[model samples]
Target chain A: MNVLLDNLSLFREGFIGTLELTGASALVAMVLGVIIAGFRVSPVPPLRIFGALWVTLLRNTPLTLLFLVAFFVVPKVLFPDLDSFLLAVCACGFYTSAFVAEAVRSGINTVPLGQAEAARSIGMTFTQTMSLVVLPQATRTVVPPLSSIFIALTKNTAIAGAFNNVDLFNVSKTLSNDGYDIAVIFLWITLAYLIVTYAINGLFRLLEHRLEVAR
Target chain B: MAEVSVTKDAAPAADELVALKNVNKHFGALHVLQDIDLTIAAGEVVVVIGPSGSGKSTLCRAINRLETVESGTITIDGKPLPQEGKELARLRADVGMVFQSFNLFAHKTVLENVMLGQVKVRKVEKAAAAQKARALLDRVGVGTQADKYPAQLSGGQQQRVAIARALAMDPKVMLFDEPTSALDPEMINEVLEVMQQLARDGMTMIVVTHEMGFARSAANRVVFMADGRIVEQATPDEFFNNPRSDRAKDFLSKILHH
Candidate 1:
């Protein structure tokens, strides 16, 4: 208990860092995911093929491998002295975006073809139909899956600790190594992760309920 | 008296409203519409009836370019349809389509659904578009459902809202592709009742449906299709009573008995 109290400040900083990284990465992943998913569904054959290849390549590769490549190898070879945090964020975001793209693509597919045809029959342009009719329905269908992706992303931020980023996991490891009781330090870190994940999951459930009622 | 005078003045030129000349459509190896020729006068209601895969729905969809034609020409209000450009948009805006499934935007209220095309396509003022949308909703007997989403309504109510949405655009021609086929038997009458009222009001329409009763009561001409071809066409009285083609007679017998 004394060890936990002494390491409280380090834990707080670690928690804040995880929050910032997760929030920024989730936002980036969502935007890129939507764009990639749109490309996957595009009528142009080459664009669709390129999007599919991107998803395949990203999804199959290990996240740790991607982080290493982005942080250590790519920067050393290309842009030396680039900020490691930025590299970590970009790597995490792009790695998760492939999963997000698949989730969104599945959601878009679930929207009936009739809805798009109906929009066209009513004289709406293709872009208008997608923006006003199809995308709203697609987004609603994807919310539950997207929420799961976000939770996974939050947990994945701990991977940044592997790069010596001093995230929650790293801070806890450092505290445990520095004469703090290992069990208690790890317990605090586990509790912090559980709280963040549980909060996000609760918000997703609330959103699902609200969407059902609105429907 | 004023309504009678307006009807009389608007009555004569109805025949020249929509015309199709040698319009043909193919879906890869499948020929959907072959040398199809049709003309709908203003205020004339034509019903295209046929079995599944007979291309009756395709025929109606072709008029709005929902399915592009492979050959021949289609003219609306004397304007030849341009294949790709702003002209297609203008042509589409002048024509409205209603589907069998009542494809209302699930995300929007009935009023917003009706007002969307007006505001986005026609650039109508918001308040004025709302007024027009309300009037259309009232016309279709769904005024109370204006604030509700599509899922909240019954199949009949949704179809009525769809009709109102199309009517709000005030298109010169309305094409219905099996508009009530997806409704339950009990719900069929409500939607058909709205369509009957539209026919009475002299709305130019081409309906693709198996609802022979609607054809008997509301349509000016009944066209029968088979195997991607119009096998026969005549006044409903003649088509139902004295179908000349063997296929039409067989189809009529099968449907009427069931």
Candidate 2:
């Protein structure tokens, strides 16, 4: 308790960092995920192949390896000035995007073919059909799955703690090294993750209820 | 599958609004449409009737180029329908389609469903589009349900809303693909009534339906198809009263007797 009280600021900053990482990665994942999902469903053959390869490669690779590649090789070749923290965010985001794309693609499948056909019959282009008609309906069914993916993403950010990203897990490890009881520190960090994940769950629950289809 | 011309009914002399020449479509091994030659004059209501698997729906779908034809030319308002891209989309805007399932956007309210094509495709301003959508809903007799989502409405109400959505585009031709077949028996007449009103309003329409009553009452001509071939074409009175081909007589006997 004394150690925890002494490290209150550490906890707060660490938690804030975690939140920032989660938020940034989530935003990146969302945009990339939607684009990849579009490619999966696109009429063009090459795009479908690219989408499939993206999902398979990213989803199969370990997150630790992605983090290492992003931190080491990617910075050297692509972004020499990129911070390790930004690299961590990109690594986690790109990995999570594969899951997000799959969830969104499955959500799109849940919408009947008639909906798209109806939109097309009314003269809407393929993009308009997807954006205005299909995506809205797809969103209603995807909240739960998307929440699950984001929750996983939030937890996965702890893996970045190894590279001194200063998230909750890293803070706990550093404090434990400074003579604080490791079990208690771990317990508190666990609670911190629970709080963030629960917040994500609640946010998605609210969205699900708010955006549910009329049925 | 042989083409049979049972009626010598002279083609209407008005401007040809939709013309199909030697249209052929195949689904893998199944020859779904075989050399379909049809012409629709302005303000004409042509009802296509046949048993299941007879390609009547395919014939109607072909008009809007919804189903790609293997070999054919389809022209609307003196312009050929392109297979894809912006030209096809433009052609589609001039043709409205109402499906049997209503197919109203479930996520959208009835009013939004009616307004979307106008706003997005036609680029109509929102305020004007909304107003026109409301007027169309009212015309279809579902104005009061404009704010409700499609799932909240009954089948008849939903179909009416779909018609309103199609009409909001001010399409030159409206295609109805078994619009009333999916409705409940009691709800069928309400939708038929709306369609009857559209016919009276001189909307160029191609209807694929099982409703012989609608055919006899509203259609200028009835086309009978069997096994991917048009077996007969005649005025409704002549077609129903004295079907010429044996296939038409057999189809009529099965449907009308049942």
Candidate 3:
């Protein structure tokens, strides 16, 4: 506990770093996930195939492997001199997007087929039916699964600590080397993650509550 | 009228609103609609009736191309059903469909459900759409339930709202696919009365239903289908009292007794 007080700035930087990483990646994941999910349900076969292929590659790979690839491979193969932090963000964000895409696709499926048909019968085009009728209804079932995926994403950001990102996991290592109790360091890290996860849950619960139509 | 090719786009008579010719469709091994031919003049009320799996409902759905056929043409207002895109949507705006399950937009208020198609498809101003929606809801007798979600309403109320939603488009023809079949017995007539009133007002309607009393009273022509074919087509009195086909006789005997 005394060690924690002594190293307050380290904990603060780590806490802020974790939040920044999560926020940036969550944004990336949501945008990519929605686009991928759109591809998954698209009437075009090529788009559907592309969506499936992306999810398979990202979702099946280990998070550690993706971090390594983002750090080592992307800068060499894709962009020269890209910051390592941005690389790790892309890794965590795109990886979680696969899970997010699945959640969104399943949510779209939960909407009864008749809802789309009904929209069509009344003269709505495919896009109109989806945006106006299907997606709004699908969103009700989507929020819960999306919350789980995002919470998992927050915890998954810890993987960045290993790749020189200076996130919470890295802070634990730095403090432990300076003779802080490992258990106490781990305990605080766990508490920080719990706060983030609970905040994610609260946000999604509020969205879900607001989305529910009367009755 | 000559045997009009689907490609001709030649306006059939000014009165002909819908025409399905040589339509054939199969669901895997079963041919659900076989070489079907039917037409409805403007303001004519056609009632389609048959036992389960007899293809009456399939026939009703094909007009709007909700259930597309394998090799045939369905013309609405003398034009072929557009394969896809905005043209098809425009064609559908003139054709209102009511489903057995009501299929109201469950997340929307009854008023929103009615306003949606008008605003999105018809491109009506929101204020105009809302006003028309209120009138339609009032017409269907669910005016008070305008702000309520579909889940909050009873089955009958939901069904009426569905009717109002379709009617909001000012469709040239209304297709009712077992509108009363999913309702409670006590609530069936409320919906049927709405249909009866629509028929009396000379709205072109094609209803697929088991309610024979409605057929006897409202249908100008009763089409009896069986095994994916039109077994009998005649005036209501002639079809109900003197069913020509043995299939129609058997179907009537089984259903009309109780």
Candidate 4:
């Protein structure tokens, strides 16, 4: 208990770092995911192929391998002075985007072709139809899957702690190793992750309810 | 009987509202519309009836370029439908279509569904468009359901909303593709009533339906198609009383006897 109280500041700092990393990486991942998903569904053959290739390659490879490449290999080969934190965030974000893209693509496909045809018949251009008619419907259908992806992303951020980044997991590890109450430290870490994931999932549920009501 | 005058102000001549010359269409080695030639006069109600897969629906769709013709020319109100772009949009704006499934935007209220094309395509002001949309809904006897979403309505009510949506466009010509086919037998009359009212008001319409009663009562001419070709054309009374083609007689027997 005494050790935990002493290391309270360390826990706070680690939590803040974890929050920042997750926030930035999740944003990056979501944007990339939507773009890739759009490309995957595009009528243009080349763009569709490229999008398919991206998701296939990233999803098939292990995230740890991607992280190593982003941090150790790519930077040394290209820009030697790239920041470690940025590299970690990029690697995690890009790795997660592949899964997110597949989820969004499936969501888009679930929207019936009639919706698009109706839009066209009424003189809306393809973009207007997609943005107004299709995407909103697709987004509603994809909410649960998207929430799951977000939760996975949050947990995966802890992997960055392996690279000397003082994320929540690393902070707990160091404190517990340094004669802190090992069980308490680990319990706190678990609770923190649970709280974060639970809040995200709760938010998704609220959004889903709102969509249902709107419908 | 309502005394409805067909609009004469800037209206084209009798042969001009819609004309198809030597139109041919196919579905990959299966010819759909073969050497079809037809004309729709202003304020005329033409009903197309045919055996299944007879290209009746395809022909109706072709008028708005929903289904392309392989060879031939289609002109709307003396303006030939261009092969691409803005001309097609302009042409389509003058035409309206209602489907068998009552393809109302499921997410939108009846009023919004009616107002969408007016605001988006015609670029009408919201306040005026809403007023027009309301009037259209009232015309279709669905004004009270304007605030309701499509999913909340019965099949009959939904089809009425679709009619209102098309009417809000102020289209010169309307196409109905088996509009009452998806309705319950009891619900069919409600939709047919609305269509009968439209015909009484002298809307130039091309209807593809199996409802012989509507064709007989409201249509000026009935076109019968068979095996992807128009086998016969006649007045509804003549077609029903004395069908020239054996195929038409057989189709009428099957449809009417059951």
Candidate 5:
């Protein structure tokens, strides 16, 4: 109890850091995923190849390797003065994006071919067909899979600790190093993660309920 | 209304509203359509009938280029169907297609499904499109279900909504690809009744169907196809009463009794 009381500020900062990483990474991954999924399904052969390669390459790489590569190369080449926090977000987002793309593509496939054909027959362009008919329907079907992606993303953000980004994992590690009750600190952080993940699951459950299509 | 002529050759007459010349299509090793040469005049109703896999649906789809032909020409109102880009879209706006699946946008309300093409394709004002869609819905006897999604309606009601959606575009010609095939026996009559009314109003239509009753009562001419070829095409009386080809006679024998 005294250990937690002594490090309340550290725990607060760590929780905030975790939230920022998870939230920002999730947003970036979702946008990138949609674009990648679009490329995978596009009529253009080159874009489909690019999408295929991107998912294959990124999804196969471990998150830790991505963070090391991003930290080592991205800062020097892309943003010399970039904060380690933002770099971690980028690494996490890029890695998770491949999963997001696959999930969204599966969602798109769930829509019947007749739906798109009907839109096209009525003079809707490919873009119009996707936005107005296919994607709207796909969105509903994608919720559960997308929620799983984000849930995995939340847990994976702990990899930022390797780069010394003071997230939940690092905070608990610091407490252990300082001769605090390691088991208690681990339990508290584990509970914290459970709270966060369950909250995310609940939010998605609400969304799925609201968007459920009537049969 | 003007008197209409049907062309039998590659070059259509000046009066032909929809024309196909030697249209051939293949899906992998399967030749879905072969040497399809047909012509329909403005406001003519032609019913195409055949056994399953005889390319009836493919022929109807090729008119709007929903199914592209491997080698042939399809012209609507003297203009060749554009292969792609904005021209194809504009051409599609002139030809409305209804599918066997009722293919109504499941996420949209019945009225919105009808209004979408009018507003998007024809650039009709939203208010005017809505009003027109309401009238079409009423005509199809599903005006009360206008606010409901497609899944909320019966198969017959959904098919009627699909018809309304096509008519809302004010197309020069309407193509029906087995529109009643997906409906239950009792439900089929409701959709056929709506189609019969459209024919009476002199809407140009090319229907692919097995409903002998519709062919007898509504179609100006009946075209019988077998194995990717049109075996016979004649006025309903001639086609039904005295089919020239043995294939047509055999097809009629099976479907008419069933």
Candidate 6:
């Protein structure tokens, strides 16, 4: 379409913005997910309660409400001059982290109890046992589910388009406002998302292969 | 559950490596261990034999404090079992445990499984750890399987690697909790042979097992337990040939006949 070539730079910025948003939020989600996963299994009661609350609250809350809180209320109440892009990142990243934590927890549970008992019997400290044995095995099982979560995250970035972030979805909105065919704009957005989603899937498959250990 | 001497006649003296006095444990409504008293002398091989759910495994597990006691004391080398944290871990390193399931760090290669505890807990150099691990694997006759993951090996080989892994730590005491129970009938003797060698070498060990032949041939003392109590403790000849309690006789006849 002539409209697409005329607005090539807008489309380029939109692609890059979607990548930036996904990358930044993915980093946030992964780091927070691991920490919250640790909390979910900690021996301390207060930490366990807090971890339970974190997953339940964020997972139960609708994404649109989170965006409203992140976009509309956060700047008014939390940070007056926060960029809407960062706010969108926060909303998406924080929301996805709850799912990430649950996936990590389930992965950990898949490791047999005897593994930890054996590690303990050998006199390995809890940290050594986790780092050496439990996490290594848990990591293998986690790859598939974590990849699914990340792919969901990549698609979920489209929601940020509504919050004034100029990502792939926003590019379609702008093109439509300028009288471009809606079908063509939507197809382009879908293709961009597929690229990102498939990229995540491929990366996780490689990771799964690397982490594979014979049962 | 009354307090009386369990293994008083056969009790060994000097250098008591492990001692449990009046240890009790419960699993919900079931009293698994009741007022237990057991001690292991240096180089003593005590084979614990009992029916299923007789608490032999629980008694062995309680040694390294894997199964916590409801009340009473367990001391290794005169120091009380560390309640938790680093001290307990350190003590566990000194007491090697071989389980029925082999528990051989499934993700690691056989060599790595043998070497990890040494390098991580004992802080041995990697080369030295590897050398020691290799030697122990050879000793247990699974040296060729070193590079393989646990699942790749047969049950017998996996159990042998497990023995080597435990032995690599140079433990003050080795606890065998039904180490060969999960093995095939042909594979069982291979694992038992390694344990026999350990007994011949005078490794301090407390073995919980169903293998009466092993108990008769290799045990310094055979402890007969039933109903969460140590019903008899005697030399293998005395206990196997002439079981004192009706319960042990019933158990021995059923086991020996079948």
Q: What is the TM-score of chain B alone in each candidate?
A: 0.93, 0.96, 0.94, 0.93, 0.94, 0.96
Query: lDDT per model, in order?
Result: 0.85, 0.90, 0.88, 0.84, 0.89, 0.88
lDDT of 1 by residue, B1-258 (tens): 000001223246555788877878888888889887777788988889989999999888888887878888888998887764456777888898899888898889999999999998889999999999999999889899899889999999999999988888888999999999899999999999999999998899999998889999998888788888878878888888888888888988998986
> Which one is best on lDDT?
2
What lDDT does model 1 reach? 0.85
Candidate 4 pairs with clashing backbones: none
Model 5 pairs in collision: none
In terms of TM-score, which candidate is strongest?
Answer: 2
DockQ of each: 0.43, 0.62, 0.75, 0.30, 0.62, 0.70
In model 2, where do residues sit more than 4 Å from their true spots?
Answer: A212-215, B6-14
Off by over 4 Å in 3: A176-181, A205-214, B1-14
The window of 10 residues in a row where model 2 chain A has the poorest summed lDDT is A206-215
Identify the runs in model 4 with alpha carbons over 4 angstroms from their true place: A42-47, A72-89, A162-166, A170-185, B1-42, B65-93, B200-202
Q: TM-score of candidate 1 restricted to chain B?
A: 0.93
**Which pairs, if any, clash in model 1?**
B14-B41, B14-B42, B15-B41
Q: What is the per-residue lDDT of model 5 for residues A1-215, given as tens digits with 9 covering 90 to 100? A: 78778999999888887888899999999999998998898766898999999999899999988998899987778878888888998999999999999999999999999998999888887777778888888998899999999999999999997686988988988899999988899988898788889999999999998887343
lDDT of 3 at A186: 93
Candidate by candidate, in order, the iRMS in Å equals 1.8, 1.2, 1.2, 2.2, 1.4, 1.3
Better of 4 and 6 by TM-score: 6
Alpha-carbon DockQ of candidate 4: 0.30
Model 6 misplaced stretches (Cα beyond 4 Å): A71-86, A179-181, A205-215, B1-14
Per-residue lDDT over A115-200 for candidate 6, one digit per residue giving the tens place of the 0 to 100 score: 98899999987677777888778987788999988888888888898789999988999999999999988887788788888988
Better of 1 and 4 by TM-score: 1
* Local accuracy of candidate 2 as per-residue lDDT tens digits, A82-196: 8878988899999999999999999999999999989988898878888999998898777899999999999999988888698998898899889888889988988999999
Local accuracy of candidate 6 as per-residue lDDT tens digits, B129-221:
999999999999989999999989999999999999988889999999999899999999999999999999989989999998999899988
Score candidate 3 by TM-score against the native.
Answer: 0.91
For DockQ, the strongest prediction is 3
Residue A159 displacement (Å), model 1: 2.2
Each prediction's TM-score against the native? 0.85, 0.93, 0.91, 0.83, 0.91, 0.91
